[model samples]
Target: MSSSIISDATSKVKNMVAGEKGRKVADLDSVSQTVSPDDRITSDFGVKMGNVDEWLRVANEKKTGPMLLEDSFSRERIHRFDHERIPERVVHARGAGAFGNFRLFESIEDLTTAGVLTDTSRETPVFVRFSTVQGSRGSADTVRDVRGFAVKFYTQEGNWDIVGNNIPVFFIQDSIKFPDIIHAVKPEPHNEVPQAQSAHNNFWDFVFMHTEATHMFMWTMSDRAIPRSYRMMQGFGVNTFVLVNQKGERHFVKFHWTPELGVHSFVWDEALKLAGQDPDFHRKDLYEAIDNGAFPKWKFGIQVIPESKEHDFEFDILDATKIWPEDLVPVRYIGELELNKNVDEYFPQTEQVAFCTSHMVPGIAHSDDPLLQGRSFSYFDTQLSRLGINWQELPINKPVCPVMNFNRDGQGRHTITKGQVNYWPNRFEARPPATAQEGAYPEPPFNIQGIKARTKSDKFREHYNQAQLFFNSLSEPEKNHLAAAFSFELDHCEDPIVYERMSQRLADIDLGLAQTVAEMVGGTKPEKQTRANHGKKASKISQVEFAPAKPTIASRRIAIIIADGFDNTAYSTVKATIKAASALPFTIGPRRSEVFPAGASKKPGNGVQPDHHLEGMRSTMFDAIFVPGGAESIKTLAKSGRALHWLREAFGHLKAIGGTGEAVELFKLAFALPDLRVSATDEAIESYGVVTLSKVSPESLRESITIAKEGVGFLEKFLYQISQHKNFDRELAGLNSQVAY
Candidate 1:
């Protein structure tokens, strides 16, 4: 052969070796590429192409003929577009995710040997996905459904996934009934009605039959179902797991993630309105908060029971439908989780990420919890069908630590191990498994001797105790909301039997609750309780107890409504005060165009430009509303029915409302409640979360924004009310129902 031919053959062989060995990749950023105008369009195989707009065809200069099958570029483009989507998760189909870090504030070395929980010096990287359980990918975010809170911790040892939900308990005790509960709550099979809702006949009937679902169903019907934002909700690892220490001791553990901002939820009417006004409300809220540098943080806690004391609980610790009362087993907060980064791309980062209950690092092992066991199996199997056998190799799912194994050759396989041997204990001792001493997972020895049977423990049968406890623990406003939720859901059940049976089932928890819902839904009102109420209450079960130690208005959305002639001084000062407190302030005007102040010209660009117009966004999208004073501005707002409705709706929803000077008269006119009070002088007065000041000055408007229980100034009082989240006192006093929006 010639010398040139031999050189070409040698180059080809070197390229093949490089391909099998695989190029070294340092991190996720190294593999990521940014699209720019400077880069040329190319095929998947990296061939630059021309004339992408037209297909290869046999035609004259002006007329085009049938496209040719030999057009590789067109064929490749069409093929890629056809298979762009993978099957979404059977549950948690709609979700939003972010990247963050988990830091151990207090080492819990005695409880477990896991480094993420024991090493206070280390910051473990994490990815958290917040989702709705029953919704499809296109469903609205504000629907009344259980929220999925799954966190994947990419620790040094391996990836540990805490597959959990906003509510600690699940709908069923055992995993065998998982399909039944999901099917019942999902859109009905016959006509597929009621998408992403439990207010249906089949769901009510299923809960009535399965008594174990009583506790979880009560939680679903509470305000917890409609969270205001993903950042404001608590997350719980519902299934029980085992934590083993260096001393070879085991303890039953339940995980908890409490938000730093405290738990808050939208009123039913507000939630319902936002579902139609903005289906991506929650998703946008999360992304915007992170983008604005108001990173959401959560306290990591664990409720632990010693191996010998596991059987001491009144309810089975392994049951998925029950919660260990905090009064009995207190939570020990040891770490903190803060999400600081948003994903670069939705498809590659958020959508492709997969979590498994079976993914646990060393020192953490699965308990014999029946529901958890089946979940561990089901999650892995489901990923196979959706992402194929080599799902773990995906960048979003791959572990940070080295992965050396004999397993190879599957669809979408990216790793190319350069080796002749692919088996363990081979002549070369290739890819041998690590022992427990070599940072491997250790299995604790425990005695297990039982006959194979399909039965739960006797304690699991006692379901009404905790359900009653949860109801009794709630505040009066919370109780009313829960009852109202029950009424609304049952009313949606067209079948008489489903609603009637469910109404009677409520008597098992509380007679008054059963009777209240029964009357509203037209069911037979129960005069007596079916089962005597234990009247037991537990701490931390009610969301009111989750309030933060210090009040904060950070990241809250406050809308400032104004017209053409508004008080520029008060508006500008209040907006600055809100921003200084780290809260978001938006201007809502009659038009998106510039609106003039009291003295400014009404010409183009001479006044302030509103962020959004009145009809463009509703009061439901904000945490509070404020209207600055100006006689002309107040007169304009007073004459417009939509503007009056905005104030009334905010009042009915129990949100904080504020006004200064002439705007105070607008509030009085809009509310029109004889019982409602407004400020008559320069001093600020807050009644039922309606803070108003009859007069305004630069000094008065510039008062320090302190969030005290009883704020002394106009700005302070208004900020304090915003921090409180909602004015439940108005609802309890029956004032909220008196106004018409």
Candidate 2:
């Protein structure tokens, strides 16, 4: 029986290796080629090259000298390296991308005839790129700015690109003002002092001058600007488009991508600090999630309004600066987007991929949205300068379906033609256009009568009403954060006129919000409202409405603090429990070297080594913390100022805290709250954001966290506290401010 089992295992191993070597994924990977082992260095022309590290020159054995210019290979290598870079994108220059599939949960054939949306059996491959709008390619990912969430779907019909952002609205309504807004927000050309920031004189000046930007500015000043992770924020197709059904019925639509993990953001202080500590925090977070098989996902939702009722709302449906509120037109979720694969290479995949607002399939049409109309032309035109005329020929941007066209060779063109005729009107009828019945996009039969003039509708005149609605919908903590964000931005604007004017504009939204910001920024507080607020609120505008369907610690980071003479049982049990819940557990000690347990003998290999030291990481880097008990360990931690500060900072940030045995006393000493509830005499107790257990044994520590209505255990309660994200009550009760870091 043992010999038969070994033979079967050996056969299985051989089969696995064979499968790994023959796997063929998407068409992009099928076309990919790699350098072979045992191959020598060769030039672009495939000629074998020698001494690639140094130029072929006349030199002595003892000393090197460059006296000859006959080294063609060395010159060629240097010449290619000099021209290796192409022009970076003017906007959304810094980004990361991934490959995913879109699966339609419910067919929307009634709304559109698009195959990708109507076919539930087909999985449409997609490429998504997340970016920051204003930053250059070298900018930090944690800067306060608008994030770009652009997606390109490779469908059976054609390529459909959803050029969107994290925010639903934009700063300007007319596309003619695109250059103006971009130039104003970019580093001021005169000095170029601020790198990837909106808190500058020119930016504030533009905000106060352009009345249409009031609504968008309110969103930028909110916590949405500093998202916790790209996987945790919402995505919106900022521009409105038209969707036509099989019966030629038209409806105005806005696209939305709601993350499964829910919308979350970092504190302003934490965001700023992260920029210095981890410039690529967002990029690393996304790559690591996919690498660990924790695929990120979002629900595809669309807000639709019949074409007959386009003018029924106060704001124009075609205005890019306005949003069709969910209260008026509810979002219909019909599909799921899951990113399961990371890019194989950054240059040929992530950086080279392009998205055009005009690219669409049948049943999808562009609205006369002024910004979108201009973008349709601008996106294609800019690609010519950045990627040359044959940009679409690049493997990353090519569609999976066959593309046959008469438009022939430009610079860097890869396709080879065999036919003599290259024009569309050739007698051979080569590359003929497809009929409407053959998956071709048919233009809508709509007549135009208006004169060609650069103007906007009268409905665009109103801007502050919805802005007021957004401000009023925010919860108390959200409102306070908004006020603080505005004050922070205005304080950075040294120009007195710029900040003073912005402060006065805030009164149009809410009097209290304006007063709060004005006081913090040292501006003159306005005595009256600039306009009536109209007192309105909209659901789903606040981030609090996006909590996950089920509470989970999956992908969460929990830190375990320890030192010499730590409780080995508690330490090992907590780590095992955290891993079983799919959460990551990290050990932090006074030193990275191994430290002996309380009951362990003083031997070489009988100790635990921590992942990091006390000074190596901060409380802000984790979601929660756990401290195990041992008399010597607790005594040492109580006296160490850095260890004490870690507890205070975590408590002030409203993160979950857990302790056992004498560790509960260490927490009390750090917060100096003797009156706070703890497990001094009982088995377990929880108070504020802290959970403690005085007497811990292997049996009690082995207890599982089960979610139930009654008789909940201490472990279950601790995990629930982490799922809540934050404890606002700690700040409301004047507890966080009392504790110092």
Candidate 3:
């Protein structure tokens, strides 16, 4: 070939590559079905129907008669509608999912040979499901419960699933008692009063009785249970697994996913109110983030302990309730997982996807962790009943690689195979199993010699040391929140035995915690500590310790409250600034339709549109609030009790607040916060996370905005405060309690 011919060919290939890169990969597009504009409605078997609105019936003179049994079209339609819903998962039923790609920026080939983890060139397709474990399908999203963080990676070799949770540990160490814990935490059998809460008599009773659950119970009581959003929480594979290298070396491993936005959680009051104000708060947060191109991402890391050193730890490595403390076994960052695409349809993709712990590729293998052993069997068994044996055939659960097996038809089977021989060792040597050298999973060579008895390792019996370590690692605010959480939960337990025993159990973790909760819940105060705390603190154990490497307001929702006669220039500048920073800003006014600004004509069409009205949405829905300058707007807002309450409540919640011109006075009038600094004349001031400016200038605002901690202007200070998420100084300073919302 000539040089010109090769150059033309190369140009065409380059164009093709660019097109493919721009094209969104709908992996489930092949299975997607839709109604078309050119086609008429049809029955199940593809017969077009003329009238789908009415039923075919035997008609009499001037009156309708009995429906005809021969109307198969109506019958089929009704039948399909009747079976539209499958049974929701026994747990993690309320969920939202998205599709994304997993990329390995740094390979771990020295530790594991799994192509998805060891190959830097592959962009593995992934579907991640975020869920609340204790809720039913219709339950609220902000309930205080463990969030399920299950991810399925479709690699070239096979599908690898990490069925994990936001919390690093579980309530029970063994899976055999899974049903008992679930039943206790669930609504009581007789009344079924509380829908999706763990603060009840039976739950506390179980906690006190099952002393092994101490460590995990601490996590559940913390703010981690009420995450601000699914995008801001961490994920952990609770059970330990084995990683086998190409050289045949083995290591015990646990998986971790650190969010790019950092770990953050809602205050208890915010969480409780959001449950009613917006039941789908987290779900909407996720969908809108992806829709707006602010994709959620997490860094994938693993903590590995060499096989020879597994038995060197004080606690059993296989214990599900314990954590391999970051100080002892640091997590090695490896790759990244990002959710870049929203699900096309909820039912076919999010709801039908399934994950099993037994599903492994070549480099990963399950450990002898008792919880994992039972889960390996339990997950696949549940899918058999929920999705049938052919659940693997579902588009969302199917692998990117080829699958060949003797497993054949069951209910809902979609595969059509050819050939007479169906079993292994066929005459033509068809579908032979891959050898060890061919990237097949080879079980690590290890011997197990033990009696077949129901028992745990000796170290499993010693559970309080790590529990105490966790309590010692918390910050003062976190500890107080945990104590308040325990007090509230135990107070709900009217049964004296439940509250009393649990209060005493707290002494095993921390003496101060036991006394605090005991006094609040009417339990006998422990005179002495049950177990001495080791005072061993671990890094990355507290939520406050996890901060984004750089300050960012990306994807955060800010509410700009405005009314008639608001400052148009200030409002427009603030809105534009928020958008440029990649944050969401909503115009909220007295009415959702339109609100005219000062000096504007009183024409109906000459006004700014608001996304929501003050009466319809509360301040709890937003991460921050801003009020632009306008004399009439401030006066009108001062008269509205709800508007004043909004500011007061936001202050009490430790949220960032900003005001300009006369709006700064309105903020002070609402809260009666004389100590809060406000701008005087033409300057600006920031006090207790509240930013105020007496004058407004679009050009000055641009110059003032900076990313540094000490911002040069009001806009800069306000945005930086919002990026910090929450100002715990107010709550920790004991000032929030002084204000009545």
Candidate 4:
């Protein structure tokens, strides 16, 4: 909330680059060119000034004893800085965005009259912005954070943005403590050291004490927190909304977006390294995926609960931090979204597209989830201060639909009314807007009669049940990731009290998880605590169950590492097969380019374009890797310890591996693996995604093709598992029985 936090505007990237390249914005030539805090201009009272000329600046060395208190310059500068920041959003501040389009699969007029959902024949242009809560805009992207999934569908009816997050629930049920939760989660005011992270004393102190945050914390610690790619994460509208049919029937609904590619996350170690290697990993990945023509897509669906049965379930539908289990309320697939393009500008489009919870059309309405209520008011109000009073008139925020109103404009107005009579009076016939029935936006009236009084809903008090459910839902690997995440974050906190309290919070969620975290962080568990509400039942809210309806190798990338002395016979065959399977096959070697044999000499330029140089690339950068066989090529690969380690790392991550001819022996040597010999039979090929023949005959090329197809096949079979994250159960079981133990 203080100006100090936001004022530390000098970015790591900005400081590391730019000056070396002569000061073009967004350059990374050298670190010294970074903007230094001391070199920046400051106000007379010592505050770092954002604008030098705007303030009353001293013209000479002589201090003119405070001149006329009416000096316009001083007053204007201070006045502007006085309101420099609107309230940093109540939640979800740091974010990234993209431009795209949403295509309808089938008309849903039978369910609702909303044009975007019902207009199956049209393609609606769209803008999507993803964000992280708690951190300021300058924070890193890979922290154990909940992502905001706010999509603005610029439809003919109007812009409909299902403002949501990757998580289905929030930290609390009621809106009253929204500010309290955010404040506690934000960097400590006395000294804001931990930026973009939530393992501090204040955050854990809040979670352990309140207990309502248990469910959310579990998610924050799991693999979901460290997504491998934004393309592989699912999105959920955290609050319930209403869909009205043409018959005036209202159906309570929640929006769901299941990634077509599947859910995936990086190991914690890789994620942490990425924070330093590339804090913009997510934003860049999203942009690159689109740029590469591998457009990211998510299947759009809605879970509709009939209003007549609003009280059918024991839990109140209006609770913000609770979810309606998929088994109970199955999601009906309605459409799909494909992000085919990236934005050309960041400031005007991606940065300024405001998503308001109250931006609803005639057929869609709001639910009274208290947090939803607070957001509807907060988003609009904050935009006014952040962008001028007429923020909607800004290009990015303005509605694409036609606009006509009797209301006059304010600061930054771009429109001019022709009529002299600005006030709507009878004398001026048809002078202004009237009657809500004439396609003039109208809100359905729901009668209310009550003596106004502040009250808390009882349903909100039963918080820990869902939290318990979320913890119990994680698989062993997922649980390990969660526990490891807890230890990693808490270990960073200076205060032992922070770790001690947070350790107990984990224990309360799952004893095993708590015990593991305690061991890792060297912290003692607190005295046993009761559930936030013991009698509450566990619910279904986990990623383990979210899988694609039909699994395919579609856009998954398979990197084939090749080099000189590679067998052209085996190489030619694998390339053809990978292309046929529809998965991209990128050849990588020690050099940027490799050639086929120039008259049987292991050499350059026979006929292949190397996509990457192995030393400069890492296995973590690709989905899977393959080695094609040649005696000399395998020998070259074996010598590069880095290339060998790439295979071992990929195997440890359970990624699919492929090989043929002598390359199979190279893979064995790379991992120090024992011999795994087999003839080029269909069964052997089917099992390991590897194929080999005694020697290269024309038939061997056919066999190599089979090997590549097998790798593609293996990817297809395990795509669901890859998306669900890793196999933690297999990992834990292996660890327990390990002689390494």
RMSD of each: 4.6, 8.5, 5.9, 12.0
TM-score against truth, every candidate: 0.96, 0.93, 0.95, 0.79
Model 2: runs farther than 4 Å from truth? 1-25, 31-41, 47-50, 602-605, 673-676, 707-711
| Model 2 steric clash pairs | none
Shift in Å, residue 698, candidate 4: 5.2
Report the lDDT tens digits of candidate 4 across residue range 585-672: 6788888865553236544444577887887667766666667677777888888877877776665565556666676567556544
Which clashing pairs does model 1 show?
Answer: none
Q: Once superposed on the true structure, which residue ranges of model 4 sit more than 4 Å away at CA? A: 1-94, 105-111, 134-138, 406-411, 434-437, 449-451, 525-541, 579-582, 593-609, 673-741
Cα lDDT of all candidates, in order?
A: 0.91, 0.85, 0.88, 0.67
Q: Write the per-residue lDDT of candidate 3 for residues 189-278, one digit (tens) a residue.
A: 999867889989998788778888888888999999999999999999999999989988998999999999999999888898999999
Write model 2 residue lDDT over 310-395, tens digit each, in one string.
Answer: 88988999988888889999999999999989888888899999999989999999988999999999999998999999999888
> 1 or 4, which is superior by TM-score?
1
Roughly what TM-score does model 1 have, to 2 decimal places?
0.96
Any residue pairs clashing in model 4, and if so which?
15-34, 16-30, 16-31, 228-265, 263-723, 477-728, 595-605, 596-606
Runs in model 1 deviating more than 4 A are 1-26
Best by TM-score: 1
Candidates ranked by lDDT: 1, 3, 2, 4
User: How far off is model 2, as Cα RMSD?
Assistant: 8.5
TM-score attained by model 2: 0.93
The best candidate in terms of lDDT? 1
Higher-ranked by lDDT: 1 or 4: 1
Residue 66 CA displacement from its true place in model 4, Å: 30
User: Candidate 2, after superposition: displacement of residue 48 in Å?
Assistant: 4.8
